[model samples]
Each structure stands twice: as C-alpha cells, then as structure tokens.
Target: MDPLHYRAFTTPSGGGNPAGVVLDASGMTDARMQEIAADLGYSETAFLDPGDGGHFRIRYFSPLAEVDFCGHATVASAVALADRDGAEGHYVFHANVGPIPVEVHSTERGYAATLRSVVPSVAPLDALAELLRVLGWERGDLAPDLPVGVAFAGLSHPVLWAASRARLADLAYDFAAMKDLMIAQGWGTVSLLHRASPDLIHARNAFAVGGVVEDPATGAAAAALGGFLRAHGLLPADGRFTVMQGEDMGQPCRIEVDASGDGGVRVSGTAAPIPVA
Candidate 1:
C-alpha cells in the first residue's frame, strides 16, 4: 500500500518535519519497508500494524536504516490514526523502546498528538571533545550552567545548550565525520539548543545518523531536552516549555513539552496532511 504524507509539528508559518505513514503495513517485509522509506526520502517513516482494542505495533525507518523510536513519525502516525478512526482518541503503540501512550485531540488547525515518552535518563558523554570538534563548537560555546550530556527519552540524543542563540543558528559541521561519530556513540541526533526565556527555547538538531543533515523538528529530542531540564532542576515551576525549532531552516515548528509528572516526559505537536508527489 502507498504511504500517507504529513508534516508533524507544523505551525502557521510553514510545514514542519515531513514523515510518511503507512497506516496498514501488516505483512510488508523489512527490505521493502527500507526501500519505501529510502524512496520517500523523509527523515523517518512509520509502519503500523493495527492490533485489537486501540493498540498498534509500529516500526520506524530512516533513509538508511531502522530507528528504535522516532518522535515526529509517531506524532504523524497518531494524528493519522485520529483522522481515520475518530472513535478512538487514544492509542497504545508498541515500539522497540517500549509502549508509548498517545492522546489525540481535535484542534482548529488540525489534529494534535501528545506522546508520553519512555522514562528518560541522562548521562555524560564519554568523548565530548570529539563530538565538539566535529560540530565546530568549543567548550565556551556551551552554556556553563547546563553541562552537556546524552539524554534518552525514546531515543538517545546528545543535548548541549548553546551559550547564545547565535551559536545555535550557525549550524555548520562535517557530515561524514558527524555520522561516524554518531554511529559510534549510538546516538540518533545531536541536539543544540538555546534558552530564549524561562519558558521558551530555540533548538537545532543534527541528524547525520539518519542520513539527513538536519531534522527541522524533532519530537524525541524535545522530550529528551525536557528530561534533561527536569533532571537538572532547570525547568519552570510547571515543568513545561515551548520549543521553537526549524526556524533556521525557514520551516519553523512548535513543540510543547511537559515533564511535570514523575513518570515520563510528554511531548505535544500538531500534524498537517501533505500531498505526496
């Protein structure tokens, strides 16, 4: 079957990250799924097998390989499910990482999805210098208060706080080298962010591991960042923040992150349908 296209985390300004959703991928082989994902050329695509009672099994694939968990694709798939079976507003997705509970809501703009991430954890990067050199960033470029570390929600991301928004905007790096490092470190993406205010943040994600230069909007990374903030006691009193991503790429996306609950970080975004060419 053909795939449905949607741009997840879209704002009024422009479409966000593009993802292909195969709503019914019951018997598709792994090689075929890989080929489809590569042909589609999105950062990631979701293959869903609907189970009984609002449960589904999902697998995520990038242009090059399969991913454990993907936030944007999950959001896209959940919204797609909402658009299809309006009767079910929530679903339980069994992914490689774990079960993800998705809550869908109807909004004026479109359908929105909130996925609670797997309980997150943070740890120091063993080879920070190598990653920094590959990213063209120095120790001084990072926020002194927020130490760089690897944060995992559903996927692992190297979370680094940019000392300033200017540092976040100037995104230049060696693609092959970045890819090698990411693969070696078992990282899905490198998250670079700047806190614009107490409740607002700006972010850029390097997705070399996925065979993409950058992810315009990354839900997993956003959730990871929220977990990192909660761990560091840096989040606002409500443990929520508004993330502004893809601004540098001119396809601005918005993500709402909440880590108030002790269980898992909640990441929310709206998805808009896009025509497949």
Candidate 2:
C-alpha cells in the first residue's frame, strides 16, 4: 500500500504528530497491516476500507500492536479522505470501539478535521498508589482540584493533572516500568496535564503502551480530559479548551477540544502532508 504521511494537530508550517494514512486497505490481512505499521514506525497508522453509504471501516495500528482507536490518526485520516474525495463532506469511520464521525472543512491555512468522539466515561484509577510509585511522583504533585482517574472517549487514558507547569515539564520516567504498568492495566496512554487557565491547558502524554516514548499530539487523551473535567465539575457542561503540547519535545502542537452536555467531546486539528522519504 502506498500510504500518505500527514502531520496531525499541527500548525500550517507542520509541527504536530505524524501519522501514516492508507487511503485504501481493501483486502489486506491483519498481519500485513501490522507489518506495514511496524515498518512505517509512526506512533499510529490508519488503514481504511471504504464501504457503501459513505462509511468506512478504519483500523489503527502502532509499531507494537493494534489500538482500539487513535485520535490523531482519525483526524489525519479524515483530512486525507477529504483531500481525495473533495474537502466539503463528512465521513463516518467505523472504528474498533465505535462509530466516529469526522467532518472536514476548508480552512484558510489548509484543510482541517473535527471528530466527534464516542460517549465518554470516567472511572477512578484502580492502582493510583502503584502508578505514583512507577512515576516516582507523590500524590502531592497532582493538582488538588483536578480529578484523578481513567477517562475513555474511545480508548482509555489515565488523566493526571499536575500542580504546575513545571511539574508537567519535568517528565523523566522509567519507560520499562511504565510500559509494563500500562500494559497490565490496559491503558492507551498516561495523560499529564497542567491547567494554565480556565480555557487553556498544557499536556504531555506518555505513550509507552503504543511502543512510543511520547506523543507530540494526543487527540484521544485530549478528548478524555475534556470529559473528565466535565464529569468532575471542573468545567461546565458546554465547555471548550485549548491544549498546547509537544513543546518540550521541540514539535509544538495545538489541539482544540469542545465538551458537550451529552458527554461527547469534539477534537479539532489541522493536518499537513509530510514529504515522503
């Protein structure tokens, strides 16, 4: 398959998470898809099998394994589909977890994509103490007002809000231990966040579960965070926020998240094509 490389959740100049988009994966086997993803070596690669009634079966694979869903890949795939089919329509993706609807529009900078996630839910972390030990962080390092739990939009992410931006920036973790913990707990990623303001947040995601050290831009985590904030009363029912991420890694990314009253979150970002090697 000839895949197109696109950087999702980035500025027009292209600083975001890179994803591989296979516009057509018609008769590909699961093993072939996994091999292709490992070869590409991106955090996530999206494969699409177009179906009738304007729907497509989407699958996401990382270098290591297949994930239930991926936010950045979803956005990237939406933009890719729009570019191929014309940038003026909405596409429904039948993902492993649920049906996610992505709408593409023509922005001044370029084409942008917005995905409405599945009904989100939040639950308390089962092994909070073990998690803290693995991260070498004390409970006091967390924000007092923020909720500590695992939130799921499509995949599960542990929502950990730091007390300060400095705390969020100081991210040196035992990758092996964290990866083991994530796998044992069946987590997608560990979302580290700092609330800069009522409408702004700084985030860094530990994506060891996906066999990546960190994710420059994590749409699933952002959507989960929005749901957690609403469920915990930290934000209103209809709230919106901006997430600034990937700065420490030198690839700055911006993500827009909107929370609705019905517990559905929308994640929006712009994707740019990357030069193939």
Candidate 3:
C-alpha cells in the first residue's frame, strides 16, 4: 500500500513535522516495514493493522530502528484514519510502548488528535558530564532551576533546559559521538528547551539514536517534558503548555501538552496532508 504523508502540529503560518502513515500494514514483516521507513526517510513512520472498530495494532520505525512509540506519527496516523473513515473518531492502539488511547476531532486549526500517554516517570541524569561533552554545552549554559533529568512517557528522553533562547538556538554538537552516547544511554531524543514563559516554550530535539539530526516536532518528548515538569514542581498537575519547535529547521511546529486529568499526560496536535510532489 502507498504510504500516507502528513505534517503534524502545523500552524497556519508554519509547516510542521512530517511522518509516513501506512493505514494497511497487516501481514508485513519487520524487515519490510524497516525498508519502507528507510525509503520514506521521514523522521518516523507509523504502520497499523486494523483490529476491532477504532482499535489497531501500531508500530513505529525510523530509518534505522523500531521504537516503542512516536507521538508525531500517532497524530498523523490518527488524522489519516479520520480522513479515510470520518471525524470524531476514537482509537485504541497497541504499540510496542503499550496501549495508547487517541481521539480525533475537527478543530478550527484543522483535524486534531489527542493522545493520552501512559503514566510517565522521571529520573536524575547520572552521566551529566558525558552528556554535556557530547552536546558541547557547559554547566553555566543550563538553567539553574531546570537542572537535568531523563524522562520517559513511552520512550526515554534526556531533558535539558537552556538559560536563554540564544543558547537554545546555538545548538551544535558532535553528531557521531552524540549518537553513540544516546545509544549507550538508551535515550530516544535529547529534549533541549528554553522556557519563554510558564505556559510557552521553545524547543529542539537531537534524535541521533533514531539516525536523524533533529526532530522537527517531537510529541513523545513533549509528553515526557510535561511529566518532568510536574514531577519537579515546575508545572501543576493539571497544567497546560505549548512547545514551539522546528523554528531553526524552517518547519515550525506547535505542540500542546496537557499534564492533566488522571495520571497520564496528554499531547495534542493538528495534522495536515502532505501533498505528493
């Protein structure tokens, strides 16, 4: 089947993160899925096998590896299903990360999806020096209050808060070495952020482990960040925030995070079809 392409977390003024969605991936082998994902070369691709109505078995792959979950791909896949089947669709997905509940609805921005993540956890980073060495960042460059931690919603992400927007924008690190470190640390992406306000944030992600330079809009990382914030007392249990990413990449994306309602963190985004060229 042909892959469906969509850019998730799009704003009217800016493009968003692109992902490939295979609505009918039943009976496909792991090798076949990896080949397809490598061919598509999107940051991530979602493959689904339909189960009961609104239920599916989903899998995520980067060019190089299969992952537990992918937030942007989930958003894109949800919208793709809605486009094919109809709006106000409720979906239950069983990915490698476990079960995820997603609901798609039409919004003023466009077709949007909300995915409530599994209960998350945050842990202190033990290899801070090695991490800094890989990122080429210094102790003084970090926000004193934010510190650093590894957060997990579905996958693990090392969260770093820059003291200023300037610091965040000047992101340059040893890619090959960073990839090695990320692999050793069992991390998906490194969530680098600068808090613009209590509810607004500027962000970037280094996804070396996924064989990518950066992720334009990382939904999974956004969810994990919300968990980290609430755990650290930076955000209330029911707080809401927006993460602005992909600005430097020219694919500006907006992600809404709700660390509210029960113990799960909810990540929401709008997805639009990517026209074939």
Worst 10 residues of 1 by lDDT: 81-90
User: How well does model 2 score by local distance difference test?
Assistant: 0.89
True-vs-predicted CA distance for residue 110, candidate 1, Å? 1.6
| lDDT per residue (tens digit) for residues 77-99 in model 3 | 99999999765799998988889
Collision count of model 3:
0
Tens digit of lDDT per residue, candidate 1, span 1-277?
7999999999977668999999999999999999999999999999999899889999999999999999999999999998887633889999999999999998878789999999999999887899899999999999997778899998889888899999999999999999999999999899989998979999999999899999999999999988988998889999999999999998899999999968789999999789755
Candidate 3, residue 43: CA error in Å?
0.6
User: What's the number of clashes in each of the models?
Assistant: 0, 0, 0
- Tell me each candidate's TM-score: 0.98, 0.96, 0.98
lDDT of 3 at 252: 95
Off by over 4 Å in 2: 236-238
| Stretches > 4 Å off in candidate 3 | 236-238
Selected candidate, larger lDDT, 2 vs 3 = 3
Alpha-carbon RMSD of each model: 1.1, 1.3, 1.1
